[model samples]
Target: MGIRHSSAGKMIWLLALASLIHVSSLEAATAETVKQKPPRLNIVFIFVDDQGYYDLGCYGATEVETPRIDTLAQNGVRFTDYYAAAPICSPSRTGLLTGCYPRRTGNEVWVHRPDSGTGIPPSQTTLAELFKSEGYATACIGKWHLGFSEPYLPANQGFDHYFGILHNLDSYEVAHFEDQGGVPLLRNGEVVDRNVDPGKLIKLYTEEAIGWIEERVASRHETGSSEPFFLYLPHTMLHEPLGVSPKFDGSSNWGLYGDVIQELDFYTGRLVDALERLGIADETLVMYVSDNGRGPGRNQQQPIRGSKLTTFEGGLRVPCIAYGPGIREGHESTVVAHAMDWYPTLASLAGISIPKELVLDGRDLSALLLGETDTIPEFNQKVSLNAEVPLRREFHQDLEWERIFTRQEYLNAFFYHGSHGALAAVRSGKWKLALNPSLTLYDLEKDPGESHPLNSWEIKTKLRGMAIRFQREMIEQGNSN
Candidate 1:
């Protein structure tokens, strides 16, 4: 009996010893993983005003030279089917910064002029706010057309620093309204220059951005801090009444427009080179996108119909390039992407935790950007819209403007066209239902220009149902609120 008990005790001791050894090994492995984890990446978002889909050399612009932008595409991923959230400027920028449709934020029509009282509300959280909250240095250097009011400015919206015009350069001399003569160039909410030269604005903006970047880097090195940065550089080039510096006045065969684009490219190159020199190129995510499509008789947005102010492909589709570390070189993604997607995409890339309470219309593109997946997961779903999901109204604010959508509206791939505060059309996948002038159905894949209309009952039914459901839900949600 004693001998049997001794044998059992020995076996128990051996098992206990093995378990401890396994636990110790796990602890060691976990510590190593924690130590080797990469630091959060910096982000540089370059937003240009009114650049067309084919404006960049890589996107098939034979007339204008965009060597730097072309190099950016060659070094990273270029998106062919990328689109601006709105067909015009103000709403497009609102979507980009907030990750919500322009209508949702109450700015749908054209851009805000100096006389406009309304602007992006203070209640909405911007991209700069998100980065700032995460301890990242934030700056906005260039055009800020959202608002010129005290509360609507970039500084109030979360930028640590802001240097640019309140509205378009044309606002300088050409008065859009009485008492709104010139656009005042500001720095951190103070009017720095009221009569700034339009030709020198681009160069000035570039220099300011570079100086900020250099100072930020130097300060970080001096302090031995590892804090990342978020730079939102929105250029005013290519907008109507385009002007270029003396050095690049007649540089392109395609005329003044091409000259402006080339100079834009040169400044872009300078910025990228600065990053490389600072040895942060591999630790940063650089993206280039246009605020909206170009105007008529400007840069080419060929094979797509309609221009700025219209809800056609030419007005919505714009060039998008993603460069820097982890992005596959020379890769082209035809996946459907929007300007709003950048809000969530950048958050994911920088390892920032997105607020769970926030209703985001953007999808995380980290998998696609990292080359892990060819397409976004949402696109793979059989049924895009899930109406069964409960709609949540977390933040309620009473404003002068009406709300466009609830959280439920973002569940589907449906895009609402509200260029002038009225629903002109609704798009779901390849089908577009036009409600203006006349009821028409178009298959964008077959007729990108919306030149041909398809007579299909099935498509019309599907699209009509989506539009009806969206409107119904919006009304119901609004009443409940």
Candidate 2:
């Protein structure tokens, strides 16, 4: 009996040892898998209106100070050759949000007047909506210049909460606009707060944005879920009729424009501080870009020859920076990226798939931001076309613009606008060609400031042919739509 009991004990010990070894192997495998997972990234997009490329310190501006925006570029990636989809405000915003070309939505024209047609078609899907569907809590603060009426507001789109002006604020003073005051201070679509001070607008928006961060964090903790949050904060201070808070009224030596830019910098610092305080700074992605180029028109020191209406480089080239957890730091990408690229970039970062049916002109720049690509891929670039195809029958009833544009004289007059129109540029690597209406070819790589026009007609003819082809492609896309 004692021998039988000894055999049974030996068998039990052997089985127990095998079980322990299997459990250890499983735990080790689980840990290895966990280590290989990609980190989640949260996004905080800061968009400023009418901010020039030289407005920020990182962009080579020594005259004015922009410490916070400068730090963002210093800590992450600065896009030196960034372009807006349009020289004006609304179309640019449309392109940024939709990830599609402005002309695709038939809104290349300006939308300054209150009674202007719908900015971006309501039928289009927005970036926020895509992110929200991916479990991100989205909010848009400061400026929503895409549309001006019913079914076009932020909440109507995909934003969970929105606080700021629906249209672009032309004047900085609160007293300038009468319809801005009183109730929900406009909640979900209803007027919420009556009588808001323009001087206090930035502060109010900041506090509200902070509240959103805190609320999302608390909600996530309570639900035991890990989800990212998106904050689209577009400031209106740096634009025309610049206004600064009382604290920064006399802070700069560069006049009102300088003061307003400084104030915007301060606001940026405040938002960064808020994110840090909430302990979500490292998890969040912050992208700062201007809505368009300078708005105060031309000056002796800063000659903005066309102001907001022109398509000059001064009107299209704007400051852009991206800082986040996964993006490389202290690098400058001369890749010619446009504002339209933001929507697709953000969607890609969140691991959300863009709808296949909806055509997106922009490319996902994840590889570019991660330092995986030394040169921009040809498949990921954009081509511009300067063509005039009249849409409304009434608008083209008087003359056939098609015949005129096909002729060489029309091209000459177009480039003679002196406002930067009648030109189409296609950039890949260091080679860039600007096809002007004068049948002139400009190599932007050697002459970035566009000081000298090229003397080669062959190259110009090739560029013209390319531009014409691009226009035809656009028309084909439009017809398909």
Candidate 3:
């Protein structure tokens, strides 16, 4: 909620100052008083593949140095309790792009494979489409993994330009090579590289992203337009077939995976440098988050339990950092925010209204991001804002924030779904109820590992009821499949 400074607006001031500098002080004052439309913020979201919560230095990483990403975190709002939409790739991406739970979109359960006939339904509105509708230039670079077919491709999903592989890099390995050809690098759905080397993917995707950004800036200058842009750069590394550029091979003390992580840090720096080079750093809002959490290989995801594919804290919670103009620097927020919330938060930032037909599980987080609110609304409420003309809430509980956000996620009952799309747990505030094992409850604040159990029949019954109500609502909407 600070100053929305656009590069174009800054340029306008510079030119105005150049002409008015020779004039009297009164005339020069006009340059400062001039009114110009601040360009809508350009968005560059760098979504990682299988990064653990403690994978980056900012998140307590030690084996691998992630200076670039760490710096971004140091100078931005780092969310300690940030959660991805799902524990796996496709469902996670689906939740992020569509602003709905993967189940709501019927894309939950598993990653979309090459043979999967369907993808994100055309009826669903993606983040790209939402930004594009507001006239922002949209592009999707790096791993797509949504679908390889026509209607499901990035081009049809509202990205003006699409680059990189349509699916995962694992398909190109020796085991699956016979059935699935090497992941072909594509440009607007046309194969550019027949066999994309996973080792060079970081550099290639980095170059593509930087070049595309440079082109967009050049186009803006040439066309004399201030159209903002959106770039979804989902890197392909840190998942499987760990890749690294030649320069970074064996660069870390942690071996191949560390090398890959270092390479990622380097390329991420390149992207940030490109933005600064084009004088659009302040005009851009950059976000770094993982699509899902990984096993506690080198970095234990510390304090969190379980790993990817499971419905544990480690599987859901991951590192998230937001930087750029209008955001407070060097802030670590304990407030719980999920990937799904980005959809509505970005809409509010860009000043666009969602189409009324859509039903989003994500709440608008503009207030939280702007430091206006510390806690989210009730479980049933859709956003951080008061709904009615005055305000109205349907929940019966302690709604006051009390300047504490450690238990914010519990305010909104979060149901955890495993990789296979089975309901495993329900979390409300500080307590979590694991469904399958006779409805055992755990105080997550004290036991993030989900180790200790509290034998309380009342709490368990209430949590179980919450789960039942959630499923009922989901089925009522016909999205419980």
Candidate 4:
């Protein structure tokens, strides 16, 4: 009996010892996994000024050479149904930066001058502010048209580094430069170059951007940190008073405009190459988009129908591309995406949150970017304060500004306002109803160009009601603001 009990006790001891050894191994493995886990994503947003939807090779520009930009589409996702917040600059930038309808923020109707007192309100939080909250280095290296003044400047708007012009090159009081300060180029609130040359901006921006990135990386290494970065490279070229590098002068079949595009493509390639050289390419995500579509005559195919500042499809829809880590490669998503979406999408990726009181107009697109889902989910806007999903798709505040926009009209709808803030059109799914100029209902799925209008009264009436209600809500928001 004693011998049997001794054997049993020995067996139990061996089993417990084996269990403890397994547990210790697991704990060690867990620690290693946690230690070697990748850092948060580094984001580089490349926004160009006054680019056309069909201006890039990826978007079907045969006259201009955009091979480098096309490479992004070949390697990543290109958005066909992407629309800018507005058909113009200041309003578009406001929507993209604030993630709220421009009208909601009260800047959709005007562009900021060099000496303008009114700019992006200081109360509104920007994407830079959001990224900064999560310990990411933020820099704005290019045209910053939000506001040229103190509070509206990039520095006070949450950017750690700012190297760009406060307003557009054309905003200068004089048309020509006389070697004196015409348009100032600022670096961290100091005027580094007076009488800035428009032709040289692309190169300077690229260099400054890459240099800033390198400095940030070096700082991280010196401090033994793994912090990520957010770089907003809003290029200053391609707008009015267009200029290109002498090397790229007359390089394309299309004239100076094409040369400007080629230069843009070249500099964009440089930025991408820098990311790869830094070994952060695979861990970084890059977005290339335009602030708004080009003005009349850039693409007659576009302007003949509707150009920038108009409520037509050509004016509102623009090209967008998402590349690098966490984004599906070589895919063109037809989902309706917008400029404001980036605000929430980036925040979600960084595991951060925006202010609760702020009404967010963008939907979280991280799931789509990560290859988890294709369709953007829908939710009720009323429960926005604590909702798990996005309230709706989007509302075009500048397609045509109506006096009022009722928020509770439709969960999934888009409103179009004109440059002057008139509510001109409303869209639901594939059906688009144009109010101003004419009450024409066009099936966008079938007639993407708005070439043909269907006499479907039912569809038109439904969309009209949606628009009227949306306009009512806009009035409410406007008054409250």
Candidate 5:
């Protein structure tokens, strides 16, 4: 009887030892997995106004210093061929928020009135809404040009808080409105009693943003649940009738425009530093991009010829920088992308699903950001509108509508023919044809600056066909209807 008892005790001891070993191995594995996982990234979108490709220090700009923006590029991916859906403000901003083409959304022009239905349609879902649904807090500060109505403001468009101008401004130094009807700043929906001073608009935006961040962090700490936040900071910097803060006046070697750019850089530095100080630097994503190109007319002070109205490269290609966790640093992406992409990209970052109805013109660049997209997809794009033909012999000719019959017709005749009425373009591979019943073909690979035209009938016809197909698609997709 004693021998049998001893044998059973020995077996029990062996099983107990195995269980202890298993628990230790499981704990070690759990610790290893936690260490390997990347931190959750918070997003901060810093959008500047009328900034150009050569506007930043990293993009070959020698005129003004953009050291802070440069540091962002050093730590993140810089897009070389990034584009805005439109070459203007209101429309492009609409595209950025909704991830849909502005033309499709019926916001093909700028909105200048408070009652104008020119803002983002209430029916449409914005990035903020999508993020908010998934437990992220969102705020939009500076330049809400969509519409000034209660239903059209930032809060209604998915933002928890909105602060900024109601429309485009000719002078950033003047009052936005004559009375209470057009207060420049608001929280949620009520206008702040202290009107936003035009000269200090940039500083105000930065200060408000920092405040928002601190509030969010505190709220998370109190709730014991950290809900990530999205900060959309769009500044009216480098825009015409330039307004500079008193400290930045005469601070730049380049005049008013230069001074404004310097001011922009300074504020951008402050925003980034605030995040770092709050201990959210590595987890926060900072994206610096321009809404569109500069003015179409020639800059008497600079080398570029064109201002906000022209269809040239100077009026289309803008500056864009994306920086954050897990992103490849200092790498440049040549992928043809637009502002509309931000919607889906931000959605993906927040682990939210984009709406099915919101057809996006731009793709999620996550692969590009993670160093996975080696081969870029061909960008076959076109900008189409009814153009007025110039009288063969006169400059002040009557306006007449000519339906650009085919892409071939448009490209064979109209690229770079920016007269007055309308213009369109078709870019495929290295060939880009900007047309308006006047053919202007450009090999972007060779002439990245669009300084010379190829002037070949074969290339023109091929691109024109591509443009026609694009136009047809646009109409069929209900984008032009």
Candidate 6:
């Protein structure tokens, strides 16, 4: 009987040992999986309204003190030849968000009133939508001029939170010809104030942005979530009818405009400080840019001809600063980049897959921004035209138009000017062909001011032909829509 009891005890001990081994293996596997996951990346996009190409200190403004914006450029990469998608407001924003040319959405003209029926279509995918799909919290905290209707607001357009005016802050004044009375200030689709104070708008925006970041961080900590976030802060300071808070009043050498700019710089510094204090500076990507060129008589645009209304370098070119992880410090890139490129670049950085069916006019700039390669693949290669047939009219709603350039006609660098539905000019590398009543070609490299007109029969003929073809294609695409 004693021998039988001892054997039963030995069998029980063996079963316990096997169970311990199985539990230990399971814990080890979990640890390894956690370590293999990539860290989440955050994005902060700061867009200034009607800021000039040389408005900030780093970009070369002596009167306007912009230390914060200058520091951002010093710490990150600056683009000397960056261009906005359009020369105006609404169209520029549309192109930036959709990653397509403004003409593709039939929004080439500037949108002024809130009652305007035109806006970004619901069928299109926005940058916020792409980021939100990957579990990022998205927010827009300034100047939302895309649309004013419930269906067109930022909340319906993939942003988790929206706060600011539905259109320009100056829309509240009665002097403007297109004034829609007082603009509605909103928070999450609800009207908080009808007539917002322009003097306090910049300060208020900065404070709200800081608060949003803190709240998001605390919530993530409590929930133990590794999800990232996207913040779009579009300031309305430098536009017409500018005003600065009492603290910044008469603080700059350039009067109220300069004072407003200085205030903008300070508040921007506050945001950067917040990021550092919250311990997310290393993981966040901050981009500072302007919607278009500055307002006339309000800012300087030396060496670049024309202003906000024309199809010239001054009208399209704007300051661009990129700072954060994975970006080379204090670098300048002359590779022509547009506002539309941010869509694909940000998505590529976050490891999100773009849909195969979606057509993108912009190329992924991850390689160029990361210093992995100086050359962008296919940047200079001509696009093939015969590979795909023309898109049918039914697909027009989807913006399924033919490629902009054919392989034989493609230039190393090209920019089309579609201001107010008219193709005014075409810039192919250093040559610019303007078709305002007559065809005039100029070499921008030699005459940055565009004072001298060149009479090159060969270059003019080639660019003129390309322009005519482009116009014809645009007309055909419009008819299809």
lDDT of 2 by residue, 153-254 (tens): 788788898887665455433334566452124545656565554566677777888888899888878987777888888775565556678897878877
**Residue 413 lDDT in candidate 1:** 51
**Candidates ranked, most accurate by lDDT first:** 3, 4, 1, 6, 5, 2
Please provide TM-scores, in order, for all candidate models, with all chains considered together. 0.84, 0.79, 0.85, 0.85, 0.79, 0.82
lDDT of each: 0.72, 0.63, 0.75, 0.74, 0.64, 0.71
Choose 4 or 6, whichever is better by TM-score.
Answer: 4
Q: Give the runs in model 1 whose Cα sits over 4 Å from its true position.
A: 1-30, 171-182, 295-301, 379-416
Candidate 5: misplaced stretches above 4 Å?
1-39, 171-176, 179-183, 193-195, 295-305, 377-423, 479-481
Query: Which structure among the candidates has the greatest lDDT?
Result: 3
**Total backbone collisions, model 6:** 1
lDDT string, candidate 5, 297-367, tens digits: 23333333344556666766678888765456678787666677677565544445455445555555554
Write one digit per residue (lDDT tens) for candidate 3, span 356-465. Answer: 66677776665565554566633222332211111111222333322222233333666777888877888776788999868789997788777788999777877876
Worst 10 residues of 2 by lDDT: 384-393
Residues 1-481, candidate 1, lDDT per residue (tens digit)? 0001123332332232222222333245554444544445788999999888777788777888888888888878899878888887788889999887776677877778876788888978898998999999999999888976788988898899999876776734247533544566788877787756777878899999989989988988999888889999998777877888999989987798899999999888888888877766656778999987874323334567667777777787889999866666678997777887788667756656567566656666655775656876332212112111122323332231124433333344546565685666776656778866766899877777788988887666556555655566556545654
Which stretch of 10 consecutive residues in model 6 shows the poorest summed lDDT?
384-393
Candidate 2 vs candidate 3: the TM-score winner is 3
Summing lDDT over every window of 10 consecutive residues in candidate 5, give the lowest-scoring window. Answer: 382-391
RMSD in Å for all candidates: 12.1, 13.3, 7.2, 11.5, 13.9, 12.9
Better structure of 1 and 3 per lDDT: 3
Error of 4 at 479 (Å): 4.5
Runs of candidate 4 exceeding 4 Å displacement: 1-36, 171-180, 295-304, 379-389, 392-411, 479-481
> Candidate 4's residue-wise lDDT over 368-441, tens digit each?
76564676643422212112334433354444433333333364466676778667888777888999667899
Which parts of model 2 are misplaced by more than 4 Å?
Answer: 1-31, 34-39, 171-185, 295-307, 377-436
lDDT of 6: 0.71
